[model samples]
Target: MTTIELTAEEMAFAGKIGFYRDYENKQRSNIADYDTKRFNLTSLQAHRLGVMCEVAVGKFLGLDMLKQPPEVWTGFVVSEHYEFNKGPDILNRFEVRRANVRTSPIPLRKKDLEYSAQVVQVYVPYTQTADGISVPTQCELLGWSDSVEDWPKAETPSWSKNGQARVVHNKRPMSDLEVMV
Candidate 1:
């Protein structure tokens, strides 16, 4: 496992794509526009940011996002609409979840099991400003159970505001987890 700590510049660059909650729907926006007018962004920018984060995580893990496994590479070759697939974002098979703070738990949807058999969780911690702009700070490889059955047992049941089933687990501490770069 490797650890990658993102620099202030990298994080700030990632912050260009931002999100906001409008009533029940979560809206995307450009940070620059938000700073001035707090306007929403097109779906294109949101999709691009998702790909960027995935690529950044893959690069940190030493995998070339363009030349990795078909599944991983396919994630990068997308525009307009984005597809949500099961498993990790990188070819190394570590399930990656990005959170606003280091202490935030990784919330894995109950139905997604594509990468549940994998034993490692690449938890990326990021920081966001008061206005909802954010940048990823660091990545940690959390060694979890290999058995998919163990995952549900390890997580605490919770429901999203929209009535979706989910589980959250704190797992190992950020300091104790191995760093992957």
Candidate 2:
């Protein structure tokens, strides 16, 4: 497997973009807007991971992340009149999903299946410095899949605060994904 590592400069740049975008979301969201972000993460954390993963994938796809601004994924539309849009994660062609080295099923929320092309998986592993601060120094592009249409539908691994189970449109296995070059 090929390993992808971001440089110190890339790290700083990604963090800056993530912070500003997260801040923008907070400022723009009104009470009527319901946050669709899952996984118990604050909006800031999600934005950071989202940006870094997309950058890493772009690098894997032969793009210079530094020379280009990261594209923000506009998720499900909040307005009643507007329909959902295909939010591609990179180059308007792929959707990126965060995974781990151990491998697990890639879960896509029911509304997230509007992506136009392949579902690409990326695993970002962290390392601890001598000072004991954890930093991401390793990333792996596990695989890609366009056959999510055949994947099994299931409930989210987590339950809501009220104990209602949310649905995941595709819970596709990691091992089943096609290996990336």
How high is the CA lDDT of each candidate model? 0.44, 0.56
lDDT per residue for candidate 1 within 1-181, as digits (tens), equals 3466655654444443222112112444433212212213344334334444555666654665545544554442222213433445444354554333444555554433555533334544433456643434655554343335545555544424333234445454334424354
Quote each prediction's TM-score: 0.48, 0.61
lDDT of 2 at 113: 51
Task: Give one digit per residue, the lDDT tens place, for model 2 in 1-181.
Answer: 4577888877776777678667766757522213344334567666666677777777777777777533433321223212332456555566777763426455444334544356666766654356533547566766665624533444445533332223334444445544352
lDDT of candidate 2 vs native? 0.56
What candidate 1 gets wrong by more than 4 Å, as runs, is 1-53, 79-88, 114-149, 161-165, 168-181
Top candidate, metric lDDT: 2
Q: What TM-score would you give candidate 1 relative to the actual structure?
A: 0.48
Query: What TM-score number comes out for model 2?
Result: 0.61
Question: Which residue pairs clash in candidate 2?
Answer: none
